[model samples]
Target chain A: MHPVSLRKIAKVYHLDAVTVPALAEVSLDIRPGVFTVLSGPSGSGKTTLLNLIGCIDRPDEGEVIVADQAVQSMSDDALSDFRARHIGFVFQTFNLLPVLTAFENIEYPLVLAKMPAAARKKRVLELLDAVGLAERGDSRPGQLSGGQRQRVAIARALATAPKLVLADEPTANLDSQTGAAIIALMRKLQREHDASFVFSSHDPQVRAEADDVIFIRDGRIAGVEQRTAATQERAAS
Target chain B: MNTWLLALRNLLRNRRRSLATLLAMVVGLTAILLFGGYRSNILYGMETGFVQQSGHLQVQRRGYFLDGSDNPSAYGMPRYREIIDAIQRDPVLAPMAVVVTPTLQLGGIAGNYSAGASRSVVASGLVANERNHMLQWNDYDMISYAQPLALEGAAEDAVVVGTGVARKLQLCAALEVANCRQTPAADAPVEAAATGSPAPDDVLALSALEKAQQPRGAYNRIEMLAATASGAPNVASLTVVKASNFGIKAIDDIYLAMHLAQAQKLIYGAGRPEATAVIMQLRHTAQMPEARARLTALLASDFAGEPLEVLDFQTLNPMYRQTDEFMASMFGFIALLIGVIVLFTIGNTMGTAVMERTVEIGTLRAMGVRRGGIRRLFMCEALLLGAIGSVVGLTVALMVSWFINHSGWAWTPPGYSYAYLILVRVWQDVPLLVGSVLGMIAVTVASAWWPASRAAKLQIVDALRHA
Candidate 1:
């Protein structure tokens, strides 16, 4: 079964008395083990779509199925449980908790999962080394550079071994080299974990590297494009 | 990290705000504790004074409480020995009894023959010498009363007059009426004539004339006149012995004391021993209620068909009870005020905390931290604040109490003669301390509830977008 299936979803937001459409009649399916990107201009509902897929939000009208379960109709508490078990998230600003160290940020989800202490430690240590910041495990978010902070956020996202990882403009705050490196690390981790990677971004590098890219405009899906091997090779060079 | 550790780290995020919030809690707690401690001291002092002055329990003919002030002998307990014996036999009352003294309540006219000094006074007659030792040990101000009543030597047949009565009669050092010739020149200061008496402007000169007309030490012969229970006038002449200060101005102005037998002879005629009341002191104030109840039952069984009432100190002195109730109400209002102030102070702290961590909350929510976990985090934070504040505030309170106690400050309450020092017994106040601290913890946690719920209920998209 597909890890995510959205059927004719609609979402409207009211800003004061004015109505705005964030998404309209959007239908999509995300397959397992694929690196996917929702590419759009600002205000085109990429983040909103990612939020709905992550189960952090629900469509105003539609069926949202994640991991063979109907997510849109679930209660808030049930949604929270489903999300904790099935989804991970990374944010534009690398929303690492300021008060927690790098290691703790990675360990947070495992703690919520009620994993045993020894296993939790082993999982966090492996993620920190995979993100190439094993030595910076004790450093708080404030002590890390933007690139390092994003690495910690990525490590945190994969710590729960979720069925899907949802990131919203995860590289927006990093330098080009750091952004490229973060993208490379996320792809490598996605392949190794066999988890579907769905992220919202306008970055061309992200679009070039993605297995599949869905383009959105004016609150609706514009087109779908697959990355050819030649395009991936060109982007890597 | 554990939730509690995370809460601690969050508190450290804003050191100044956290410290300010902590200080607010500490101050509120300290205010409640110190005010409560000071009031406790006031109640303690009043209780001690009341107990020493009137004993813990009193037994009398029902008529004594009802109307014996008018004719004390008419309501006298002629069989007081039997009642005292029964009290000594009761299992509850026997062990608790410290001093059980028989007393005769008397009212009469006091005068000196040679100096022609006269005044009306109310009096108590007791077994003088032993009671004097008892008074010396208990009444804090009794040390100032000149030489207690002794049953022999120069003091035999002598009555102790109150300072007010002594001054009224122009009695000298030995409480003798003024006689310049009989009083050795060295002992007589002539101050009565030199300074004149303290009187109102219109009567000041008249008082001076009266002082001059009397000599020092001549009227050693003192007389007491009263109407017996049968309404016949009776008089007894005795020597003025020692001037006494009972600390109460109203009592001092007219009180007299003498031997119980002498008073019994003067009022009820010789060979008849009668007492209006019997007062009992207990080993501990806590025992008073049980003693009163058990003794009342014992008295009922012993004096079947007789009119007798057993009264506790509180019933006999409504003023003390009224004062206690007033203090309780005032302290209760203060406690509630402090509680409200602390509540708002903590509520504001948690509210600011929720606002400051919006994006972080959104991230956690997206990562699947439940709303209940968020609420629990804030609640733990509130609990930590209260616990830390209460421990620190209790220390501050103890220090302040020690400083006040050792500061050598003393005050004389309205009806007291000597100044007493302010004392704060912090160690003895464990219940109040524990109770206040626990109450503060509960209040602080409760204050965090709405803010915690607000934090937990934030919309992930909106919260993440908050600047």
Candidate 2:
């Protein structure tokens, strides 16, 4: 089964008395173990579509299936449990809890899963090493650079060994060098963990490295592009 | 991070605001405990005084309180000796009673011939040695109220008049000086002629006007006169040995204490022994109910089918009962007021903290923290705050109480003529400590509920966008 299957999903938001359509007839199949990027200009409903797939919100009219379970049929608690067990999320702002150290932030998802402390500790150390911040495990989010914070958030998102990692503008706040490094780290971790990654971005560099780039415009899927391995390598260089 | 650990770290984020909130809690708690301690002290003092003044239990004829006012000797407890013996024989009662003494109350007139002053007085005849020693342990002024018993010195006819009675009669150190009645200093020792003929030197020093006041050189002669139980006139021309200040305005105005036998003979008749009541003192005031129950049972079994009533201090002194109730109500109101202020302070603090952390809350929710987990985190924070504040407040309260107790401050309650030292009993007060601590914690948790729930209910999508 595909990691995510969206069939004609639509969402509408009401601001005061004004009705605005954020997504309409958005259909997609995100296969496992692929680095997928949803690319569009501002207000192209890229984040909205990502939110629907992550189960943070529901669509106004459509079927949302994540990891072979239809989320609309699940209760709130069941949906949260499903998300805790199978899905991970990364926000545009990094959203790292300020009070937690890098290690603790990374271990948070495992803690929510009620994992054993020894295993949690082991997994958190591994993730810290994977993110190239093993020496800075004790540093809080505030003490880290933007690239370092994003790395911590990325490690946290993969802590539960989720089937899919959904990221919204993960490199939005970093400089060009830091953002490029973050993207390389995410791609490398995606390959190492064999997890499908679906991230939204307007950056051309991100679209170039994507195995599949879905372009959305006016709340609809405007086009799709498939990149060859050689093209991806050429774009990365 | 664990939830509780995260809560603690969050609390430390705004240290100044948290500290201010903590201080409010500490001050509120300390005020409640100290005020409660003060009231407890007052209650303790009043109870000890009342019980010591009129023993833990008093056994009197059934009608004594109601009808004995007109003819007190007529309602005297005829079987008082039997009741005392029974009290000693009972296994449950014998250990409870420390002192059991019979007293005779007589109403009469007292005259100071040297000062040409006379007044009506209420007299009590007590077993002198026991009565005098009992007063030594009393919480009232030992100097003013109990010192006069020493002057009697086995003189059966001598009397100790109340200070109010003495002031009214103008009986002074001697009649040698004029203006002895011009508002005599109330604290002067009762120095007068012996309970016999005066010394020649003392008589010689008397002014001519004093001489005219008392003929036959019996210048210090004070006469006590009362009617026998049969309504026949009886008189005892005795000398005033000393006077006492009983410390109660109503009692001080008309009190006269004499040897028990003399009072009995004067109020009833020669060779006739009678007592108005029997008073029982106990080792501890808390043993009142048990002791009273045992004594009353014994009294019934000994004098079965007799008209008698045994009463505790609370029943005897209804005014003290009312005063205790009033104090309890007043303190309750104070505790509630303090509790509400602390609750609102904590509630407002938690509310503001939750409002400021909307985005953080959203992040937590998105990370699979359940609503229940969010609520638990806030509740845990409140509980920790209460626990810390209670410790500090209780510590300060105890320290302040110790300081005041040892500071030697004295206060005289209204209607009491003598001053007593201020004291606080904290260690002995388990109920106050437990109740205050629990009450504080309960109020703190209760106050955090609304704010925590509000935070937990915030929609993740909206909270993420909060600035």
Candidate 3:
């Protein structure tokens, strides 16, 4: 079964007196345990589609099925619980709580999930090591470099071990070298953890690394491309 | 997860703003407490003064309080001694009544024979020891208003006159009254000289002609003249012992005190002696209702068929109630104003915090924090602010009270002749202290509700894009 499925989902935003269509007629299925990329330029409804799939924003029309539950049929509080358990989010700005340390930031979602403190501490430490920031756990976001802060954000997103991890232009703010390293790290973690990883990015490095690439334009999917095993091996090369 | 710790960390994020908000609450609470303390001090002081001077309760004839001064002899309690005995032996009043005594009131003319001057005077006759005991009543443990009468142990002819009376009768120098200024127009036998009327104050001349008599001496002595029960003129020679001020000029000008015999001899000569009022001092002011009720019952059952009434200190002195109400209103007004200022101060601080943390709120909401959870965090911050502010405010208030009490500050009341030490009483007043502290903290917490609600209702998508 697909980890995230959007069937004819539409989202409209009202900015004062103007109503703009952010996404329309978007139907897609994200296969589990694979790296997928939603490649689109700015204002192409990439972030809007990610928001709907993560259950943070509701679609104006159609069904958003994430983790086998139609999100539109749930109450706000129930949707929050569902998100805490089944989906994680990564923002382009690396939105870490400034008042908390790196370890606490990763542990925040587990706390929201009401995980036992001992288990939370264990999971947070493991994720800290996986993100290559085991020594930086005690440092706040203000004290970390841009690359290290993004790594902490990724660790926090994966702390609850959700079935789906959604990233909105995850590498938009980093340099070419840091963005490549982050993409490689995400790819390695997805292969090992076996969770569906969906990123909204137009970067060539991110597009080259994905097992499936969906092209979107003007809130519509223009095409979908799935690589074979040999094609994926060539892309890896 | 420890939400309180998160709230504390958020509070510590902007230290200066939090400090400013806390300072507003602290100052507001401190001002309210100090004002309340001052009001308590004033009312307590007034109560102590009245209780010391006249006792907590007085039993008098039915019309005595209103018209007793018109004819003190007519309203005299003839069976006062028996009534005093009954009250002193009563079951309820026996434990509460510290000093139950009888006093005689008379309106008469006092002639200072040696000075050759006389004036109309209002006099009270009492047992010097009993009056002296009544002078020491201070139930609130406040500054003492006790001043023992010098008439204690003195001869029956001895008397105590107010400083105004001394000046009125031209006895200031003789009484050794410092700063005594005499207006000559009110003194001397000037009325007779100007109008050619028989000098009404010529007690010696009148004594010889109208069969009036004085004691055979030319010392510091006065002859009290009053019409007896039969309307016959009578006189008793009194020796002046001490002159004391009664604080109010009107009462001081005509006030005098003498032994009961001297007063009875002058007013009820050759007749049954009586007292105009019986004074009963109690252990505390709070026991007034029970004392008044018990005394009323005793007056009705034991001393039935007699026209008498029970009057508490507050009733006898309406000035205490007026002053109490006036100061209370002033205190409440000031407290409300300060509370409003504190309310808005805290609300503004929290509102600014919500504005600054829009993105953080969006991030938190996205991480599965419900709206109620967002509201709870801000409320926790307000509770912390209130708690800290109340404690520090109480400490500051107590320190201020202590400083003022030990500083020897004194001010004369509106109609008083002398200044008293200014004091602040709060700690012993449990209701005022606790109420003020709780009210302060409650206001602090209440002030944050609007901001917390607003923060909780923000749209997560919009908040995330605010930056």
Candidate 4:
């Protein structure tokens, strides 16, 4: 079964009697164990779509079902619980809390999930090691490179072992090489954990690394491409 | 593990801002403590003065206060035993001494030997020991009145003159009134012998009549002669022995405690040896209230048919109330001013804090923290600030108060001739201190409400967008 499904999702922003559609009748499905990239220019509703799937934002008129539970019908508290249980998110700005170290940043989601401190610490250390940042765990985000910070962000997103992880422009602020490295790390992590990775991006490198791609233009999906197993085997070889 | 630690960390996230808030709280608290302490001290000092100088209560003849002429013998408490018994029975009451004395208000001419001039002076008769007791309570020790010095070949009738009279007369020890007497000059040969005498017997008698007809000063020497009421003279001589220089110097101008027995005998009569009032001395002033109540009850029961009045020091000295009222008003004004300043400081600090954390608050809300949690976080911060401020301020205030008390400042209220060197009083449970501290905390917490509620109600999307 698909991990996330959006049916006829519409989002409208009302600003001073002007009705501007942020997302219009959008419908999509996200399956497990796939790196799906939504590629669009700015204001193309890619981030809006990601927000809806992540349960951080609800559709104005339509249904959002994640892991077979209708998210649009859930109350705010229920949505928060749903998000904590099934979804993880990474922002474009690498929005790390300045006061927290890399390890603490990774542990933040588990804390939100109300996990046991000892378990959280163990999971945080494991994730830090997996992200090749074990040495930098105690260093603040400000003291790390862009690649290392993005690695920390990805580790934080994966801390709770959520079914779906959404990244909004995760490589927007990194150098091309660092961005590529971060994308590679995310893809590797996704494969190892069997977690579905959905990211909105305009970076070609990020788009090239996707197992499937959804092309969006002006708040509507233009095309959808899926890499078959044969194609994955060829790319791997 | 506690969310409060997270809240505290958030406060310290911006070091400069947090320091500013802390500094403001410290200042507000310090001012509150100092002003509060000082006001409490003044009030306590005045209360102590009142309690020490005047017994908590006094009892007198019911009519004595109004008419000022109630006779002591007329309203004497015959049931004094019952009064003492009642006082002993009440646990909350303490009993002191019961005494009786006489008082008189008289105006008469006072003369000096050297000038032979007399001035009108006011005289009051007091019981000697009772007067001494009153003076001692008033903190006066060096007080004196005269007893007559012996003179040979002189009239026994004599007077103890006041310092004012002594200074005016220029009379010293061993001075004789007869030597100092001023006689009217011959009066022009007694008006030329008041027409010529006719015969030897007539001539002698006429000379005696002429001498008698000449105007003479009332007496060669004036005396405050002690006598029986029926005009039988009992001569007793007195001289000024010692004097007092403190506590109402004008008291030296008036005679006091001139032998109540002698006064009563002289003023009323030998047979009517009665007093006008009673003066009581007590071991402690605290015993006065019960003693007064018991005495009043006793008098009412014993002298049921008679009219009497009771008076304490408060009634005798109207200045006590005036002084108390003035001090209270002054303290009240100071408290009000301090309260206003503290409220403003706390409000401003909390407001500034809210303003600085707009984006952080928005982020937390977007992170799915409940609005109630947000409110709790802010309120907790305010409470923390208040608690710290109160503690630091109180310590500072206590120290300042201690220093001021130990510094030994000399203070003199208006209309008083003598100055007192005293320390500031300390009253730990003064209502103002407790009320003000609580008031400060309340003000601080309430002040945080508008800003905290505003933060709580912020739209998550817009807050996340806040820079």
Q: Name the best candidate (by DockQ).
A: 1
In the range A1-237, model 1's lDDT, one tens digit per residue, is 899999999999999999999999999999888999999999999999998999887789988999999987788888888888999999999999999999999999999899999999999999999999989999999999999999999899899899899999988988889999999999999999999999999998887789888999988999977667786677556
TM-score of each: 0.87, 0.86, 0.88, 0.68
The Cα local distance difference test for each model comes to 0.81, 0.80, 0.85, 0.62
lDDT of 2: 0.80
| Candidate 3 Cα deviation (angstroms), residue A78 | 3.6
lDDT of 2 by residue, B1-467 (tens): 67778888988888998899889888988888887877777776667666656777889888786678546667887677888788878888888777788888878877563444567798888887766555545442221233536434757777777667766666655323222353333222223423323333422333333334545745445667677888865667665666566767688779888888888888777646878888888877778888878777777777887788897878878878898899889889988998999999999999998899898888878777878888898998888889989998899889988898889998787887678677766655778889998999999999999999999888777788788
Task: Quote model 3's TM-score.
Answer: 0.88
lDDT value, residue B7 of candidate 4: 59
- Please compute DockQ, using alpha carbons, for every candidate against the native two-chain complex: 0.77, 0.61, 0.63, 0.21
| Candidate 3: residue B6 Cα off by (Å) | 2.2
Where is the poorest 10-residue window by lDDT in model 4 chain A?
A228-237
Better of 2 and 3 by DockQ: 3
Model 1 pairs whose backbones collide: B178-B215, B178-B216, B179-B215, B179-B216, B179-B217
**Residues B1-467, candidate 4, lDDT per residue (tens digit)?**
34676657666676776666667666765665665555545444444344333334444456654554323334333343344354445444433543333344333434332233334444444445544444344221111222222221222233344444434333332233222332332122322433222223433343344335433532223334333345443322233332222233354355422455545544565464544444444555556666667667766775676454556665655666676677668766865676666566656766776676766565455445566767777887777777777767667667776887677776664543345554433346456567767876887788778777877776655555566
Among residues 3 or more apart in sequence or in different chains, the pairs in candidate 2 whose N, CA or C atoms overlap within 3 Å are none
Worst 10 residues of 3 chain A by lDDT: A228-237
Q: Name the lDDT value of residue B382 in candidate 4.
A: 76
Q: Over 4 Å off in model 3, which ranges?
A: A212-214, A226-237, B61-63, B66-93, B105-109, B113-120, B182-219, B225-235, B260-277, B293-308
Superposed model 4: Cα runs more than 4 Å off: A1-3, A66-86, A221-226, A229-237, B57-84, B91-356, B420-436
lDDT of 4 at B371: 69
Name the best candidate (by lDDT).
3
CA shift of B311, model 4, Å:
9.7
